[model samples]
Target: MVSSSSTPAAFVTGAANGIGEAVVARFLAGGYRVAMVDLDADRLRAAREKADPAGERTIEAVADVTDEQSVRAAISATVEAFGRLDAAHNNAGITSSGPNTHELELSAWQRTLDVDLTGVWLCMKHQLPVMLEQGSGAIVNTASIAGHIGYRNAAAYAAAKHGVVGLTKTAAIEYAPQGIRVNAVSPGPVQSDMLEASFERRGAAVRDWYYASSPTGRFASLEDIAHAVHWLASAEASFITGHCLSVDGGWIAQ
Candidate 1:
């Protein structure tokens, strides 16, 4: 069903920086009212200002995605502000810095799953109810190449992302009949401030290795993944539910 209002609305988690920030900008550019949800209050505010300078179409929800109550409140606030939810992107996640699967601490594994897997689930839990009531919505989850394949040392992150993909598929199948389409974007290495910082710390050799890993010999820009996510949540992808669209630079193919 089309939105009752001429202006549609979106709620995006992890909207402070990187792909999340880019996604917010993309949605705003497309004329959608967006809720920018993130744990960093200052950064979230900065991002909202950058995306919607006039303060006409964006709301800042300073909530941690891992907390159930926080996630619920964020969604509630978004609905109260916008009147309805037309789309959501569960993009908040933390990567694991584990040394190896056998050497990883139990706490580390739990933390990764709590934020990456459970956080996405919690967002959907609240967002789905709103969409269900409206009988229309779209949801996009941020998976990763680790979800589809494997990441050498980041066992916990990979497992959590894999769970995200599974959850996306399950929800898609269950809600399609109700006019909600669910999908995921699995990105490989992306060109972002975080990745750039990693390069600075790890040196040129590490950067070259990442470049060589991708068949395209380069990392994806944040905009690339953001565009894929926006498209998945738009009407253009109405029939593309349960799909995990890869924004990798052909890395997983090899």
Candidate 2:
């Protein structure tokens, strides 16, 4: 329930596909200006074509979330395009290198941490200044259910996501006094390209095993996660911070 006068601009990373794309669409539909950032230029363009046909207030930036220079430039571009940044969804991240933690290469582990954990830090590093200047803002980070619990072969991903939740909580408290809120959204198995790729690699039986374990007997949808993020960034959540909102279809309840 953000005030109409403060319908602020938003920046969303990893917006080329899946949940990121859905978040962009939801924000745009709510009449908020948005800047979408992704490493894949072609995919970003396609997402724009599908989500922001009018192109009235949508800005697209091709950048790597792991690269500080790219991220800084993208944030700068967002501010230049929209005048100010009032909200951000730091959703850009990569999966673990492989299924087996012990066998995973150091490079792979490092890459996951770089994108999933450090990337959020970099976004916050730049975003905080803008938000502080405005004296009001909200940030919703994309963590995973793995953040709270371990998965069999996803040690690196789980560790990195756990870091995200910790960072979100600390930042939330540090900035709450300044009228800035930071929160994390932990999604369970969601029906996204990420999950589809994992299914293709691991087979339907394995994927079905996960779905069956969920209390809801199903995976969450992109829109399901998007709705949660939208709520976290809205003014209705003004009193909420240092919170990890789970949109995991009862996966954690079990």
RMSD of each: 1.9, 2.7
Q: Report the Cα lDDT for candidate 1.
A: 0.91
What would the per-residue lDDT of candidate 1 be over residues 31-54, giving only the tens digit for each residue?
899999999999999998988899
Q: What is the TM-score of each candidate against the true structure?
A: 0.96, 0.96
What number of backbone clashes does candidate 2 have, counting pairs of residues 3 or more apart or in separate chains? 0
- Evaluate all candidate structures by whole-model CA lDDT and list the values in order: 0.91, 0.90
In model 2, where is the ten-residue run with the lowest total lDDT?
1-10
Q: Model 1 compared with the native: what TM-score?
A: 0.96
> Candidate 2: deviation at residue 38, Å?
0.4
Q: List the residue pairs that clash in candidate 1.
A: none
Q: What is the per-residue lDDT of model 2 for residues 130-201, given as tens digits with 9 covering 90 to 100?
A: 888888899999999999997878889999999999999999989998999999999998988898898888
TM-score of 2: 0.96
